[model samples]
Target: MRASPPPSSSLGSSCQSSQCQTEGNCMTDLGSIRILYMEDDPGLARLVQKRLKRAGYFVDIAEDGEQGVEQYQAGDYGVLIVDQNMPIYSGLQVLEILSQTGELPPTIMLTGTGSEETAVEAMKLGASDYVVKDAAGGFLDLLPPVIERILKQYRIVEERQRAEEALRESEARFRAVAQTAVDAIISMDSRGRMIFWNHGAGDIFGYDETDVLGRPFTMLLDATCHEKNDPPMSFFEVHGEARMDRGIESLGLRRDGTSVPIELSISNWETISGVFYTVIVRDISERKESEAKLARMAHTDALTGTFNRHYLVGLLEREFQRAKRYNHPIGFLMIDVNRFKQINDQYGHTIGDDVLVAISHELVETLRESDIVVRYGGDEFLIILPETNGETEIARDRLVAAMAASGRFVGLVDFPVTLSIGCAHWDPQDPRTIDRILNDADEEMYKAKRANHEQEGSRAQAPPTFA
Candidate 1:
């Protein structure tokens, strides 16, 4: 036979559970978390207090159910753990008193096998969760999950209250700023039902507040919603609420059947009986267009519309890596006009520019799609050949043949323009050093120029232009 716990009384200690000193305890380390623990057994109360203290909890102990009720009524405890039997009252009685408040802290009742009826009564009286004492198997194991569940509920409730208060505060702060937020704030429910649509959202989507509010979110997603075979269940499914900070780019089909790109972030939460989603959406059509323009500019040569030197360098590096990775060879050639400066000076600068343009056109026609013909600089060009024997003399011969076939002449005598060429190959095992390779090609080009000059019996030729 066990004595009944004390009856309910007005709460004592304005601090009550708040007074629990979490110093040197796990509960304290866990952060200002509070608990109310009631037991008629003094020894058991002491044992639990010690354990809980070690776990960093703010634990307030009561010797009986009546004292527990008084402590709880003072409020501020995050959790209430009550024993079913005590001297003046039972856990059920305290639970009954707390149930009437409609806003009591989360409560867990402790009962022995003999007090099973009391446990049922405690539940009816609104105990959140329960634990069995003395005769338990897995009692200690069961304690954590019960406490965690109740505490989680308590925290959820408190957080929601805090969130509402904060949202009000935020709304006040954002009243002026909301007009200028880069993105619109739109929201819906867990079921994809719309709850909010801000002015910015309306402007971006070409919809008015009256048209979007009280409507399903799918109306905004429109056809894009069904694009995926297994479309995401909700915004939360695609981008979790936890990662709401990292925005997602989504395609939104407007009311006019046109598609607009949008960056979206969503958060899902509950308030009272309703669940809501808060989405921040920004129109990214301008951003996308800007990016596209930048990409083209990055890859293009302003003067010739061919790959720029920077892009060409990147392509060469890529090809080099590929050849190295696959144990393959690549061929490249450096070609310079035999007497370009004299052509520039005699023909005038306008004709000189035209000559370069013509040369580029002729080179493009002569090269394979796999080959790159880049204007290395004024009057000098580079050709790259993938999967070729770099040492093959045919590489230079090809350039010579292509230049002759172009039929574009710079001389007044209609003499066919010519290129003096030098070629090199990449060897993965012994690397074709960039400086040495280019230097070798330059040397060969100069050698070819000398040979041409000697063959023509004219050693009085101008040097290559620096450009």
Candidate 2:
């Protein structure tokens, strides 16, 4: 057989590298394109090694079918290209053994004689593809892309499995946080049945988590509790839209059939299985009472239990954003107590503070519920009116008339208290940041003060109002 002349070893890219066998094959980096070549001919094995390596594959050569099977048992090779005739065991016998295990790598059978019967026999023995020795070039060309594609698919499958494992770990972390949370974390099915309730839920609701699981969330509500008639749906029905941030309140019934206030934030989501809702509930009994105290503290001037300057600035920011988004107009009115320092110097700081508080009460009683009145500074206050028009002068006139009718300034001991008005409408397109808007309002307040001084020939309280 003249050793087949080793198939031209020096053919450059057409053949594998000279040092490839001893140098370790370069194709190992191609990710799953490892190949096992089995033949009794040493020269043929070397030739095959060179060719396959050049084609970007990791190749290991064995002289016998026995050695080939041994190499396959080791990890990380993907395709086996076998010579039909080999020492000790024939290629057919190797294929039979591999088939029995049902874990065989895909194989390309090689026959030296190019007999159709031999090729057919190889196929029956589980050969994935086959080639004759003289015409092996064609096989080599088709071989790589086929094996490459198979390896690519295998890699994708492995990656997906890895990703799934990572998702499982992430979900476990979330569950741990939910279990340890101080506020109750509850999840419900699309039908409003409670599916998940944390330990906090049981502690706060006075029900065992097990007893509540699978029950309708409405079961927690007391039938005799005073109900809100604003919406036709029961609180549970309203809660379905809660996750959409429709509103932040939800009413919860206690285990003892008593109504307890709850502040709820909800979220809607879907998983591989189906749709679900998650609700975070905080018992607001303590919070409401605390808020009431804070409201009284906030509404009262701090010096006199009336609204503070902080309230004015906060309301302006809120109203500005709201008016900008909805294209509604907002009005701002700034009020300053006139020449009260003389009264303070004579009547003392206690009376000065009382004068500030008394003025705030008059402002509060003078404005509508929809209006927000805030103390701007020492002896100064601001009011905000929502849903005003492009021109808020009529609204300004109403506030001025109300202040005059309240007779707040008539009983002043030293100087008469008066308000100077400057009003501007919010432009939706050029709506300013809260600081900028307040600065503009403050500037207008100064202008109004100057105007009042110019008109009355004396310093008078000026409440500048903007829309």
Candidate 3:
């Protein structure tokens, strides 16, 4: 007599050979699904293979667990169906081997009757699903559905893993950019509490992540900042409406309690978690110092350190306007160094420059702080005395007296430095432009020069005194 078929679960009385063939043929029409089958029993293995092939599956049969592992490594099968009781190695061993090779495929295990313990052990070893073999051989009907479900689940797991890996890479790139930026980059929550601070922030603010995290953003700003009236949260709420691409200049407070000028740009974004604010801060101390230096260079005379003509013109025009509006008197003194050309010819240009500088120092010393002194070009100076009504002569006399007291010029020593000064007063009622008034002073200065020459001619026989 023929050997009885191995005990296995039945698909039901209706699922006989004819019905199995129909179901297999119907599944086969869908696609060429590949499966690796491992069973020690040749009869059972052949039966399952024939049924699976009929149901649109390309099935590879392995008579033992070792052959199963070899076939699994050699072929790219979508699913592996292994019988638990096998030669060389058990089905669980085969699953473990496949897992070690790489990510194992969706797997289903076939267990003999009364071998439920072995099926459970196979699952622990990475089997996706398992079915028990019965006398009716019905487990073959359940095979196709279990493989289909496991394959669908496997695709979902793969897609999820890929998505998670991409997210990690994206976050790493963003962190790298933020940490390497030159300007301090900071992020805070809607409550104005610090959440993230990059390396640039630590470098600029002198505060490490530990010192700043969860702290109020106002701690890093001066008390006199524009947001002083609002609390930290309120300030963030107000500024979080839009992006500030252009940035505003303000003072930033350092951890050492000193203040630094900073250019700040802010931007905000929102997510389901909450709103976030980002600030980019740049220290502008060097830039401000450079600008101040440039302004001083523009307004000052290089040689004598007095106001240059360009700056003098602007100051005079402003003073003129103020005098006219207030109906006040403004005095302009045109001063020329007598025999300056003779001094340069006899003593070289360096001595002439020294003489000019010395004279400028004297002028500054004699004048009040309110007076404007200018180096009006080579060998000439201009002094503006605002609100000096009838005191123009008194001011000029005082300057001459100061020069005489210094006792370092022509008559006192050998340097021959004397000033010929002519004064003009602006009367608001006169209604003349500042330029015309200045011209009047210039003419008077020339007249004074000629008068000095005549006096020198008359006094040629005697030693000279102060002009």
Q: For each candidate, give its TM-score against the true structure.
A: 0.49, 0.41, 0.66
Sort by lDDT, best first: what order? Answer: 3, 1, 2
Stretches of model 3 off by over 4 angstroms after superposition: 1-157, 173-182, 187-194, 216-225, 229-250, 264-280, 320-329, 386-394, 407-413, 427-430, 459-467
Cα error, candidate 3, residue 76 (Å): 6.5
- Give the per-residue lDDT of model 1 (tens digit) for 345-459: 7777777776777777776776677877777777788777788863436756655677766667545424557777777766777555766776776787778777776655653
Better of 1 and 2 by TM-score: 1
Weakest 10 consecutive residues, lDDT, candidate 1?
Answer: 1-10
Listed per model in order, the count of residue pairs whose N, CA or C atoms clash below 3 Å is 18, 18, 11
lDDT of 2 at 413: 54
Q: After superposing candidate 1, which stretches have Cα over 4 Å from the reference?
A: 1-185, 193-261, 265-269, 273-275, 295-299, 390-399, 407-415, 456-467
Worst 10 residues of 2 by lDDT: 1-10
Whole-model lDDT, model 3: 0.77
lDDT of each: 0.68, 0.67, 0.77
Better of 1 and 3 by lDDT: 3
Task: Please tell me which predicted candidate would have the highest lDDT against the true structure.
Answer: 3
RMSD of every prediction: 15.6, 16.4, 9.5
RMSD of 3: 9.5
